[model samples]
Target: ANHGLAGAEFLAGIPGTVGGALAMNAGCHGGETWGIVERVLMLDRNGALRERTAADFEIGYRHVGLRDAADECFAAAWFRLPAGETAASRRRIRDLLEKRIASQPLQWPNAGSVFRNPPDDHAARLIEAAGLKGLQIGGAHVSEKHANFIVNPERRATAADIEALIERVQTRVREAFGIELVREVRIVGDKA
Candidate 1:
């Protein structure tokens, strides 16, 4: 809440470190992390850190410039928020969280959105249309409360179950709509 800059309220509801947020350009309610960035501090493999302008990045939806240069990474960031009231920023945060809780399956254990909204269409709508909501594979179930989310409501979803469910959702949606649903969440490692 220390960031009382004008328009910094958009970062209120996002969960993660500032570097992670900047890396993904995470946004919600029409505000994005990179939009507030004035400059960034990056570290190379050799422990050398340097300041870089926004121009140094090839930023886009859910990505930062370091994708091609894995040797360097984000260490810190400098924001360009203008002065504003802390109270107002806090209120905005509250409002954003309230809005999130109302629509998302906050009662369950889950990762956030599983797929990026494809072009002009929303992923949640597409998933819902595919009749995938509430579909369960073992302990992981596509959330009925929000079609885009997969929840481990019992806290028993194995990593493998979650991975299988994600692939199944992608296939089903593609078969039904002929549009390949691109994943927003990064998947890595061998399946257990």
Candidate 2:
């Protein structure tokens, strides 16, 4: 891992930028991004960069500070990770990648996990148990391989398709298990 960061290895195979990851507190395999962060560099609308430490900003699961409506954007991050053996680090990275492939729907165009794990239970388990696997709305389908993933098979699924499927899944899970599914995939923009 760069800068001898212990947790950076856990992010192997994750497709996204550091800014996005930091904003979401992105993690997998029990390693969160903020856990290794020492300092953050933010840019404002005027292109001025400001340095802020971890304590200067609020940190939580998939949350970051707003700087009180300052409209700052993440520019860079400095990680504070400990050194470790090179070979062991590489192996651990490979292992985590394998784990991700086996459990995630990586073959399709999808935006990672659609819902967060609720408490002591996994969202996939809940969805699969509800008999929602292989369900599709338009071209977007809940992955037969992993219920938590909504895949755009054939790359023909529109935003509406994905959004509709997400809503359906949420409704069904709520009705069946009495648990409201909170979306983890951030949605932006309006229907064109």
Identify the leading candidate in terms of TM-score: 2
Which 10 consecutive positions of candidate 1 have the poorest summed lDDT?
Answer: 63-72
Q: Write the per-residue lDDT of candidate 1 for residues 1-192, one digit (tens) a residue.
A: 666567877766565678678877888889888998888888998999888877878888777775355577788988887898988878888998899999999899877888889989999999999999999999999999999999999999999999999999999999999989887776767766
Model 2 spans with C-alpha error above 4 angstroms: 2-5, 67-69
Q: Which lDDT value does model 2 have at 155?
A: 93
TM-score of each: 0.91, 0.92
Instruction: Give the clash total for candidate 2.
Output: 0
lDDT of 2 by residue, 46-102 (tens): 999999887766777667776466788899999887887777788899899899899
Off by over 4 Å in 1: 1-3, 67-70
For all candidates, what are the clash counts?
0, 0
TM-score of decoy 1 = 0.91
> Residue 114 of candidate 1: its Cα lDDT?
86
- In Å, residue 127's CA in model 2 sits off its true spot by 1.2
Which candidate should be chosen as best, given lDDT against the real structure?
2
Worst 10 contiguous positions by lDDT, candidate 2: 1-10
